[model samples]
Target: MDRWVCRREKRRLAIDQENHLGYRRFYNVMWYCFRQRGSILSISNSSGAKSEQRKGKGSDRVVAVLERMGAERIYGVPGEEILDIMESLRKSKKIKFVPTRTEWGAALMAATEGRLTGRPGVSLATCGPGALNFPNGAEYAHLGGFPLVMIAGQKPINSSLHGHFQVSPLVSVMEGLTKYAVQIGSVQMIRPVFSEAFRIAQEEKQGPVSVVIPEDIAAEECEEDEL
Candidate 1:
């Protein structure tokens, strides 16, 4: 009984320490300090340092770009493959996530949010089945003239061509549902794809633009300068 109690106490202490550190780190990131060394320093002087480090490659670049464009929230149903991107968003705190019960509901809510706020509402869905569920809401956004962005997770490129589970030809599937549909197969293609998608959704006819993110590509390590 004593051993168990002691273990419990240690666990509690660890959790408390973690919570304290997290709070301090958040504070520091929100309040960076200018230094004479020609570099900005984070106040907390801990893991917040990592937060100050500029995004170099991969999903980090994507999150930074979204933040730069002033996106405050993302509405979606979490999927297995996109969890890394989700974690990246959580760390940045630039975009809050609104998890919906269904993929279709996410799309509808994104459309409504976009219309009400007059800012693009972003939604994420897993590939294959998830993408299939989004067309209805995409069509509604199109008819209503709302600007929205939907990202669907796709199977890795290797698995995609060889026929893996949940693999589908997303570009062909979403072709007519929105003004633009792009399946990003490589890290080099991420920026152009994002730029074009944003243009299609916000300009021209003002409707949803779908960008299919493959699992392998989303997990790739992006260099800091690329962002």
Candidate 2:
């Protein structure tokens, strides 16, 4: 009986010691973390470095040009392919991104806006199915002679990883329904190509126009001259 009691006491003491050591180790680790965090905060505060403006991207230039030319809003259903352009649109003060329930709904909204305002109304769509939805609205604008500008996304032009997957001949499909349809091949082509598209949309007997920008091209850094 005495032996069993002594063994029990020793086990209890051992457990107590282990618990105490664990608590001490935890406290030390927490103290070390707090000290490191304070040092990092002090270094950052003392450095006094001004945050630089983000570099301009092709998507930024696209939004800038549209804002400069008097587009008030762009209507679209966003997708991964157009994420860069959507981010650029999000940062614009003058041009707003108008989310719609469907790509077709966005196209119709743009068409109505163009008809009412007598200016080119812009709509955006992602590649493949998203872009395919615009033809009906484009036809409506074409038949009614309303000025409209439609922008569509494309797979990365430089990538062959997913060759022709989810990629249709957008330019060809859009051509039949629009006054002008062209794919932008590079960041440098954005300004000029869009300028021409806008011009064509406003020309005599105005109709819908389509412009396609590749996912990779839209995310590239824009040259100062291009911007």
Candidate 3:
């Protein structure tokens, strides 16, 4: 019995050490990305070259609306469905995209930022599996009363063809977990839907919200006023 007890204690100590190391690594990464630069968000853009200056487009409006709502950074892992949105973020000076290794980590980081800053922290993910990874952290944000906004890119809404491989009812899946959840059907809905989501996330008893923007909707053309 004494030997068994000693072994258990040793195991516990090993687990604690592992956790401490993980936390120390995360903190070091955060220091390099934000604190050392005096910016809440990292200034680095994924594309090595500067993004061309753009006045107005569907994607541009999405970025503009997010900036106007006072979002400084968004965390995400980039994927094809979300490429246009990432491009918009890259072009915008007002908001920075903080890339992460996984969707779950992005969601957790955003939630932590939201909790600390008293604003809705934004997380982005691609459709299907990419978005499926978010619920773990998203549910935590909801239960903890963190103001988090989960923005997911969806498969093209226009396709009626077979093999809508990555397509799933994301809005339906997220509805139960988030205070506000919706799928964007057009460029016109982008601004109002996200604006309402921001309001809901920041209101009393704050929690998480989910917005699913379809690929075609993001690719669609738009005048600035439409958003």
Question: Please, what is the whole-model Cα lDDT of each candidate in the order they appear?
Answer: 0.81, 0.91, 0.88
lDDT winner between 1 and 3, please give it. Answer: 3
What CA RMSD would candidate 3 show? Answer: 24.4
> Could you estimate the TM-score for every candidate?
0.73, 0.75, 0.74
Predicted structure 3, TM vs. truth: 0.74
Q: Kindly list the per-residue Cα lDDT of model 2 for residues 1-227, writing each as its tens digit.
A: 99999999999999999999999999999999999999998888666342223457899889988987799989999998899999999888998889999888899899999999999999999999999999988999999999999999999888773667789889999988999999999988998999999999999998999999999999998654556
Per-residue C-alpha lDDT of model 1 across residues 1-227, encoded as one tens digit per residue = 99999999999999999999999998776566424223533345644666557444466767777787678888888888687678778788778988888888989999988899877788888888977888988999999999888888887785535747777888897889899988887888888888877777888578998998888888887766777
- Model 3 stretches with alpha carbons more than 4 Å out: 1-55
Better structure of 2 and 3 per lDDT: 2
Candidate with better TM-score, 2 vs 3 = 2
lDDT of 2 at 178: 95
Q: Give the candidate number with the greatest TM-score.
A: 2
- Kindly report which residue pairs in candidate 3 clash with one another: none
Worst window of 10 by summed lDDT in candidate 1: 33-42
Q: Model 2 scores what on Cα lDDT?
A: 0.91
